[model samples]
Target chain A: MRGFPSDEELMKRCKSGDLSAFELLVLRYKDEVMNFIYHVIGDYHRAEDLCQETFIKVFENAGNYRPRERFRSWLFTIAVNLCRNELRYRARHKAASLEDLLQADPLSERFLIDRADTPDMICEKKEREEIVRRAIESLPESQRMALVLREYDSLRYDEIASALGCSVSAVKSLIHRARQNLRKVLLKAGLGEGYNAGI
Target chain B: MPGYRLKCEEVREELSAYLDGEVPIWKRGLIRWHLMRCRDCAAEAFELRMVSRALRAWGDVTAPRSVVENVMRAVRLRRRKMEEERARLIARILRIAAPVAAGVIALLWITLLPAFYLSYERGKVRPLRDELVTVRVIPQSELEQLVEGRMF
Candidate 1:
């Protein structure tokens, strides 16, 4: 009555230099980790590279993983740290902010739009998505990260705290502030009807 | 529980945590109590809820297939390099070990084997040989007489 090996079990095997187990882990979480990075930094190509780097770091540091820790939280912690470093690098180099960079890349935005919609609808939807992305990017680093982890990845508060290396209370505050900020923006843009009617 | 009531600001602040189900049961009941009577606070909560839904409905971007492919490729390459390094280490050890082993055998033949044989021959075999008896045989002419009388 044995099921498939868990993430911790695969990590244990990875510690013993089992590449197959490492590959299984990669195949399982690659998209999630990549998408998280993309959302955080708003760059697809760099996210791909950082996603690969995250797995490589996990592979190299497999021995450091304790069985008691949640594998998903630990994995996110690595991804978050790399995103921070990338952001820091961008700041240090005076590169354009994520919102501006994403604005310049309309082709990348086009792929995210559904083709079933008419051209006009597609343009409108793309504009809405861009506004949302921009509103997200405008938040402070910790707030943006907390909101994304909770909203997209559906991590528990404790998991978000662990991934962000903060206390649960701090995470709660960050998410609350992030929601309030987004609510303001979404209401102004008239993106969601519930916002206009209810508020 | 009967006397407790949360202020409007307090309820609104913790509303996100309440929505996420991170609040304790008692506080949750209090927030619910406040939202029931306060129209403004209820509207605020509803707005936040809708905001959460909108973000969720923002949809997702799928990770390109190349991400996993490139990751696995890097992992496999590193593994191959590690294997090659181990092979080289073993080869180096053998390269060093083969000569050392041959030298030890040569040294043993040159010094120890002869010394062992000499000691054994002088100490045990020569003394044992000195203590033995000898026997002699009759000539052919005496054999004919021995055949007639069967005496020696």
Candidate 2:
């Protein structure tokens, strides 16, 4: 694993005019970046758009990359900024309930643990997941982003702080406050054994 | 902050870090003690854990196949557009320059031909005129005397 060209190496190759290396870089980070932005913006389609734009910017501006910086953080910096822009756009346009919009996609069988569980229980679980999803969506941008990066990407506090252009303590406070907000939102929508089922 | 019975607000503050295992060992112990007895704070911790779990379970969202294709497509499209613009600009310059060059050549020919013709006609008469000047011209009287003297 150590012998393989790291992301920075690939980026350097990309800087020297290797499209294949850039493509490799894209393949490496695409899903992670997509999911990060997806959680941030709450719309998968728009997340995909922003994810493409992020890579495009990276590809075009590979020359600007400084090797001292971590590529993942640098990449997320671009991603989170784009997410912010989309969020601003959504706010102005009064978009609502991204889970509702994207919920049309059928839950794969993996979400169902046991066939023995009654369909009613399954529906109840899905309903609770949706509520949790909406509660997450309702968080303020910075808080929501911190929570997403921390939980989904599993980035360290300092790394997340780097990505978000904030201090580590600020990142911690953001996630903490975000949890408090989530608790309020979730409990208000009714949290009990069902919402906490899978966990 | 050590060796103190933890307040619920303090536990709330530490929940995210505690869930992440970022809390110090002693602080974690403090949080453990707090959650053991406090139902509200414990429930909050449980819910936050659930949230983290749900997002983690999202796994890879797996961007549609078109995303990668679209990125490369856009790159190619921009390159093509620039190539077309460069070609169009060259054509535009040629369009302007070709007529101007032809006009200059035509003007030069139209102006120089008459000058060349006049020069050629001048060359034909120049030596004749010079000869007439070099020879001494005799008036008609001198010519008649010469002819009368011939009778003598």
Candidate 3:
């Protein structure tokens, strides 16, 4: 029966048996969390389910919430853990779907676009994007996670270190290696000539 | 080594920090000095820079609106279910505790009621204790006297 509350206030209310407060919290974070998961897992439906599961875990454990840490960090920790579990499950099952791989193709949609650009140019860009995406996806999970936190989430290096539970130097190394791998992939995909000519 | 020629490996090591602008000033200057003279190192830097650019572009890819809404709905339902579950647990605990409390009160009443009645009955019957020989037409005084003689 009160005005809408901020996230911290909402969390307090949720702890005190306020479902509406919990729902508000869900609405606030759902999209961002989903986006994070989608990029990590490269699947919409699975990411959605994981997003739901993440909030469920958050709700179930809300009673154990300590306000000392930021709620966003806590939420991301849960989401990242879920992403790890999903990756592990896929690995153990050996069920890495080609569809999942294609979904990750940075340029897969470009192939379907009816753009008026020259086919050669479109194809070239698509190939470059695809190579970059694949290279990212193929990195060691730790490196990939660090890269994602840094590049996509716009987290500081220290923040990424905290998220990945690593040292700042380690985070730096991970991103460096990830970039190195991406560059190699891009080179193999034939962007090396023009790229080299530019510098 | 007036100007050391940068190798591909060395260039690769600095590429990440160079793109991020995280390299130390001296190291950056060194890489820059090498970039100016070493065409191979320069080319490699360019390629790596392009890769970083492409990665930044990928961040622009947005998930569909329907996907966002569906995920949110799923999250809402999950939270609602959890809330219901927590309420159920509390209700269950209360259900268990309430009857135990009531039973403890009931047990206390049952134990005390007879004891209270018996104490009241004892007070009322105390005076009658000395005069209870009417069954065989014996006088109350005679009964008391007989009992006293037997006790002495």
Q: How many pairs of residues collide in each model?
A: 0, 0, 0
Measured against the native two-chain assembly using Cα atoms, what DockQ does each of the candidate structures obtain, in the order listed?
A: 0.40, 0.24, 0.20
If you score just chain A, what TM-score does every candidate get? 0.91, 0.86, 0.78
Which 10-residue window of candidate 1 chain B scores lowest in summed lDDT? B54-63
Q: For each of the candidates, what fraction of the native contacts does it recover?
A: 0.66, 0.46, 0.31
**Full-model lDDT for every candidate:** 0.86, 0.80, 0.72
The ten-residue window of minimal lDDT in model 2 chain B covers B51-60
Descending-lDDT candidate ranking: 1, 2, 3
Q: Give per-model CA RMSD.
A: 5.8, 12.7, 10.9
Clashing pairs in 2: none
Scored by TM-score, the top model is: 1
Q: What is the TM-score of chain A in candidate 2?
A: 0.86
Off by over 4 Å in 1: A97-100, A103-107, A192-199, B86-152
TM-score, each model? 0.78, 0.68, 0.66
Using TM-score as the yardstick, the better of models 1 and 2 is 1
Stretches of model 2 off by over 4 angstroms after superposition: A1-3, A96-100, A103-122, A195-199, B1-11, B24-44, B54-60, B79-152
